[model samples]
Target: MAILTIPVAYLIGAIPFGYLTALWARGVDIRTVGSGNIGATNVGRVLGFRFFVYVFLLDLAKGFLPTYLFPMAVARFTGHAVPQLGVFVALATIMGHNFPIYLKFKGGKGVATSLGALLALNWVASLAAFVGFVLALVVTRFVSFSSMLGGLVFLAVYFGRVDDPWNQEHLAMSVVTIGLFSLLVVRHRKNIVRIKQGTEPKVSFRKKHPSGRVAWVLIPILALVGAGAIYGLAAQANRRSELRLQPYDLTEVERVGTGHQRTERLAYADHGKLLAVTCPRYNRVVLYHVTKAEQLEVARDLELEGKPVAVWTTRDRLYVLVRPSGDERHVKPGWWRAFDLQGEPVGQPVPAGMYPDDLIVTADGRHALVLTSGRGEGDPKRPAPALEVFDLGATPPQVVGRLEFDQPGDDPARIKLSASGNYAAVTLLGSNQIAAVDLANRERPALISRSNLEQSEAPHLTESKDDSILTATTPDRDAVVIPWPKTVATRGGCIACILPQGAGLTLIDAATRRLLGEFPLRAGSLNLGVARPMGLAFSPERGLLAVATRSGSIHLIAVRDRPENIGKHEHVAASEHLGRRR
Candidate 1:
């Protein structure tokens, strides 16, 4: 389905609006008219400026339709969004306009078509390029020279602002931009020679031609209005392509377990029907059954051979990390053991680093990542904190790669994989930073970027399904949710950071890294009625956020409301509580 978009784009772009308009209006072949080219400029020179406006707009629509709409339509039909296909679609549209099959392989120079495609690809760069074209024409009055200059401007501005060259979509767009710019220069070779020889035609508005005067005044205004409309459409398309956080009010559904048991982590399996909580102090994992009515009921407890630090769940298996308990803690190595959903051991334990605290499995279930603090108890030589990667398909899961932190006290706490499963974000508690690790090479994971949170003490981290946002818990009792740095920038504003300890969650704009807003976790000053909120999990299918606190209570918050419904719901005052379990 995605592959079919290319040919469709070409067919759409191949429509010769300039030639058709000339034939219908003046009974003349636009290709044989003045300048002997079937383009808007030649049509205006031979026929009238009105015909040029009509043909240019028609040409623009052909490029815009395929470049902007094809990827969106493909994504709607297929479950996955393939934005990289837009680049190919844009190139095909321009090529079709430059060499239309119906015109015997002869067509326009593709200036208007390229502009329309560029507008869809990146509106800011497109606008800048348009401005460059207008300025160049105003100075030199040479349309051909301005068109070539505009193409160069688009390439410069587009490539300059790319934040992530490693991103798949960005890389594809870069290649296409270079290809289109080269094509533009090649097609305008005769124009360049004419300009150098002082034989190129210049646009003129003589006193005898009132239509030229009217065109000089109306074209800029029309272009401005058209650019504004295209910008709005591009913004809407981008919003639809990405995942957005809906306007939600938290409502505590139920408090399932007792307090003070030190519930360290939570994992859901069996399609969100089973919830597993790890209790290191008790050396066991408590399994809960979530009924159809959304109530939690304890099903059973699985006792482990050692203290359970964290638990991860797949479709049919449960992996539990067990650390040495009592005096042997941090001295003996920890191990991860796999079990069936029934809590029966399936394979021999795989030895991990000393003081292993967290584990995350890849989307394919072919690899697992374990984060170990590597803190040695009174030993002269302490193992450096590291992220251990394993190949799960092996007979005995073997360690394929490892990433060790430079400092021994980095004390990495939690690791979370991005939506694409090509990257992982790790929280360095002792360093107050978050490390973004590239997992493109599964066997040789590399640290790509590290962001410091200044005074924030990082502990645990979670990511949105689209990898657009990352939320991390701070020991200061705040959950900081920031846009993932790798994502393209969108609408954002500054949010004031409120330091009322344990009061709420903080929102930060990923582009600026400034505080956005704080969402309090209290129902009329009642609080979550728990202290030290730690683990956080968002269930998109259920639209519920399960927050595990050290106080041993799980607070289920409803975040189900769509963004468009925000206006229908009353906005509660800052002093008032939003919602809570009654």
Candidate 2:
């Protein structure tokens, strides 16, 4: 089904609106006109100015529809990110306009189609391209010269945006940009020769009659005013749409004690009965009893030596992954500490990893999964983060097996062990992929497979073999991991989307290694601002999925059959905002 995007886009681009307009309006073939090309300029020579406008707009739509709308539809339908795939569709549309097979391999110069494509891909770059065209045309009055310059400027403007995700992950966008630029230059070869010989035809804005010149001046002014008014109204409408997101009522606010103000990670324990929140500021793990209404009641604070960064709980045990405080003069290392469900110390702290970021206990509480963010290049031996499995049945948890990533920068942010303790879904922030580790093999945990998230082009980095595949953008603070219910048919797990940049949640099928759906994070009454997903917990029995943000706002989304579809209610978690609460 996804294979038809390119062919469909190509057919749309090959419509030849200019040729048809010339034939219908003047009974003359546009290909034999002034420029001997079936484009807006040649068609305008044979047909009236009105016909030229109609032909140009039709040509533009051919490129715009397939590039802008079709790929998104396909991506949504497929569940996987077809980002670079969209670039292919865009390129195909432009190529069809340039050398259409329907016209016996002869077609327009692709300037209009390219403009439409760039406009759809990146509107700012398209505007920049238009400015280049207008500037060049006004100075030289040569349409061919202006078209070539516009295409070049479009590429330059689009590529210059180093910060855009599309320019970074989708390297194919660069290829298309260069291809469009080259196509324009190659198609304008005759005009280049004419310009060099000082015989290029310059467009005369004025007609032979005085009234035609007056009409031209009046028409441009009217068009500019109409365009401005339309733009103003559209901008107003967009603002209204943005604000229309329903705001959810504040549900609850769990505050920290004095000096324990900075809070970090959140975890569920004892079948969703307990919520253990890590507060590094006071080196403690604060436990809470979560009510049915999704409110947190402070249960107890378990103090630890090192700073608590992440926590996980079993039916009878509490596991806290702690990192050494920077103020330590003796240079204490990072380790793991365990305690009973009642918050009593179980045993002495054990050596976990260099920088433990997240952990997940198995359903039976016999094993655990830990994700450690690597200590950077300062240390050569432990330069990369790893997925470590711990045998919890032992007195102090023992590291049974480990799987480290090849890239030193592959910093793992979160980990989720499946209900049956079969697999551990690990989100690697640095690499932008979710590595699913098979935990069934306790003696040797293996990295069974991985799935990429939706990603934009990473333009700054050199292209690798894997760069062709589109993945999700990982914000510095984006981290959420939730395993699917064992009873549910869905294979793997889901994660909260990186907000503001890539807004939505991504659900992946662990069994097939396929994306089930990319669901938006929009709720009934809440507007998602710079809401980074800091924590995620699923209530399968109640069909509720709760997402906690660093903005101190927790959003509850209802799920039906799958995470791909959003539920009825979504709102702020607590009765009061975290900042306002005592």
Candidate 3:
């Protein structure tokens, strides 16, 4: 019953309203015509602006329905209140719009879908994104550029004004929403190329078509039906389950810095005896000695060539990713350096991709994997999404092999290596796919397989959203989770719009190079917080998994225990407040 919700939501979002509208209005495939896109923009260009508005609203509904209405329906049918499940449904809806399985896994740019989802998830941020889009569109007269800029604005506004900006509560949601911006930027790569070549088309405001009556009638009918179905499900859910909001216990919460500097990344090193945190504004890695009692004291700060973005540590060495400073004209495009345990330079700086964001070192300290985002700074055409493997056994860990992807902006963002270093799994953020490489053979790493994290099955209309009443069998004990609602509220905003789920983690079999499964982390979990998993470190000695969430806290999970037994400890650079528990 609980599992049926995501797939059902995906199917609902998979409807190609724009493409269908264009095909019905005129006998032309929207993908083959202007812009070669099936989005509302392309549909509008082929048909008319008035028709485009209809398609846009419908596309937005695809995103809105699943997040706003589907959750209540699932909760009603399953008799279980899964609040964080809405995040999964919302993401699935956006994913369906971007990569609809029915379209042979080829879909739109997802700007409209993401905007709609954002509206459902955070109206404030959605409004910001909308404003950015309109302003940029009016100024540039280019939808592609405006959409990309709008996404960036959305990120800025979301992180700036949403709750406590630097807390762990918003970290996971921020990471996920930022990924939406990345998706938009990556998808619009070709458009950027066209703009640079001075060949991009400017949007034209055309008149409305006279035959838009069908769309108007159909859209209203569909909305009414969707609303009624949602209401019915809500009644069922109300009768079955009661919302039980439990409180999460925090082990300890302490401020890190002076609240002036931002805490970017946290890592446990020296066999979990030392904690390394990257504070970019401070332009240094602050080392802290962790006592057996879990108390942290400032050890020292290692100043770097530039602002540190990420860090990886071995038995006796530390690796840092730094973005060159503006005045440092001598620094090359590559960025990464190695240092000894005492914070001494190991040798020369290692050459990496355009923008290296994440890195991981094997337990044996014999190999290291670096994800170079390849998306060059200041230039959209300079995408070099690549994975650089280094032989750590070498004097300064020489770059042994480089693995590149065929996709233009398929940047390997988050990377993880197995405990034994037998295999490496990388999340290609741009494509919503994961790639596994056989790292057993260090000299020549082999690409094992690439799997899309998102489900590949195309969503199909399973039931009528306008179904006024459900059959008696639907109330049966074994009935599947019905997706429609009896009544959907027409109010100020959506319920989940202001609420978002945390980031999720998926497991991959290191030896087999296959994905095991996905596990929901933050949000709806017993841990009532958001987790932006920046780094993963497994300590076999302590039987604990140390996760460096890009926030003010570090989450520790017992490898041998259940998820509910996991704990989150907040520690910032601020030493003024210590030993505080929440």
Candidate 4:
């Protein structure tokens, strides 16, 4: 089905609108007319400007339709859209325009068709090329020269603006751009020679008739004004549609503490009625009661013996992991403390590893999965970064299973379980990898998949910070479940992984382990600016995702389940920052 688009696009482009229009209107072959070319320029020179506009639009539509519509049709049938399909369609359309089979493999120079294809592929690059074409035409009054300049500008802007030139996603498009540029140069070789020899005919705006001359001058001025008005209206409509289509809205941004304190983890419990935020800077676990209006109100703060690193909650219990303060060399074993909903201690602090970062409790509350990054010094027996599974039914929750990472400084940051508690996903900050574990066998959890975020197709995951002070003090990576709502037809859910180095969220399909998409945390008009998003929590009942940033503010984003809004939301690119870590 995808391969058929190329031939269809070629056939559509093969329809020589200029020749058909001339034959139908004046009963003359456009190929035997002025310039001996059946292009819009020749049609206008032989007939009039009106015929030029008609034929140009007809030609443009042929290129635009295939490039824009085929990929969508293919995606609807195949369940996945191949972006490279558009590049093939674009090339086939241009090739057909340049060499129409009906015309004995001879056709126009493909300038107009290429422009139409470019508009469908990348609008920004197309806009830049059009502007260059207009500027060159105004200066030299040579249509051929302007067309060549536009192609060059298109290539320059397309390649120059990409953040990662060698990205696999852009490889096919890059090859297409170079091919199109070469085609333009080869096709316009005769025009180039004529221009160099000073024998090329220049386009003249002046007309012999008085009314014709006046019309020419007024038409351009009015066209510019009309185009500007249309562009303004389109931009306004796009913004309105974006607001309506977006699933989330930033309702409130409540600061956790003094606005300078770093908040690490967040967990919602009691069916989204209670919120727990672990603040390591203040050495306490702050609890918030979620109001009916979706606003957070201070419930209570549980002061701990050590700095609280991570938090989790069950139906009637709150679990907090605390680690000792100061340098890694002097760091001692951390503890996991349990409390009731009212902030009262429920059990004695259980001794954990040297540096326990995050944990998750099973649905039945029979087991607890803890992630510990053993980076502490002065202890040769200090356990390596590992995922420890404990039997919660046993006294003191004894460790029943353990899976230690082979690398020394993997620095596993966060761990989260699937909705059914059958699988787990962990983010390894130090190694720049995300590991998926199969928890179907509770007694023996097994590593199923491991993906390096930096090398993955997910965009903006390569950027990393180098400031050791920030790295040591702040919580950087997190993973939260975007549960599939019962209201929506889709059966499976997605995982939103936050990469602090990139300051964006990478969405992965939980069932297939495929990367769905990546989007920046730029809440444009809502002003919910996120910098180094440290923690995330999702409420299935309310369809809300709470993001806790390092700057000490919690953002509540509502998730929508409307079928129309599933994959239609716009994805904005995140701005790049300098630096990298090993």
State TM-scores per candidate. 0.48, 0.44, 0.41, 0.47
Q: For model 3, how does the per-residue alpha-carbon lDDT over 1-582 read when each residue is reduced to its tens digit?
A: 556878887877787887889888888899898987889888887897888898889888888877877768877876766645666777788888888888887888887878887788778768878987996786567999999988987786566444244433454466778777888889999999999999998875455433547667766776787599567645532331111111111122222331213455656677877767776655778776666655556777788777787788877888888866554523345568877766778888876657676777778777778877655323455556777788867776688877776564475656655545667666675566667777767767778888665433111111223322111110000011111111211111001000012243333222122332333334211232344444444443443334443443444443332224222221111111211211
Task: Give RMSD to native, each candidate.
Answer: 21.7, 17.8, 22.6, 18.8
Q: Highest lDDT: which candidate?
A: 4
Residue 317 displacement in candidate 4 (angstroms): 0.8
Candidate 4 residue lDDT tens string, 1-582: 999989988988888988899999999998886877778888988898899889888788787889999998999998777757998998899888889998987899888888898899988788889998987786567999999999998886676444233434456788889888998999888989999999998777775424447657867886897599667645532331111222232223233331324566888989988888877766777788888877788898777788887788999999888887755424578878889998999868887787887777888999888888775222456777789898888877788888877654477776756656777767777676777788888878898878775533332121113210011112454566565544442343555667544655555544445555554443222222334567778888777677776545566666655544444322111101000110
lDDT of each: 0.69, 0.63, 0.60, 0.70
- Which window of 10 residues has the lowest lDDT sum in candidate 2? 240-249
Predicted candidate 2 versus true structure: per-residue lDDT over 1-582, tens digit per residue:
557888888888988888888887778887876777888877766676787788889888888888888878876887665536667787888889878888997999998888887788878778878988987776567989998888877776565442222323435676778877887898899899999999998776776534446757866776797599667645532331111111211121222121243345666666776767666655777777766765566788778787877777766788888888754512445788788767788888878667677666777777777777665323555646788888877876788888887664577776655545666666677567777677768769888887774454220111133221112333233434343444332322343334444555444322223333444433111121223455455555444455554433344554434323222321122112221331
lDDT of 2: 0.63
Lowest-lDDT window of 10 residues in candidate 1?
573-582
Residue-level lDDT of model 1, residues 242-340, one tens digit each, is 122324444556555432355667787887777788776668787877777777788778878799877888888889988988768746889999988
Q: RMSD of candidate 4 to the true fold?
A: 18.8
| Ranked by lDDT, top first | 4, 1, 2, 3
Q: Indicate whether candidate 2 or candidate 4 has the larger TM-score.
A: 4
Give the TM-score (vs. native) of candidate 1.
Answer: 0.48
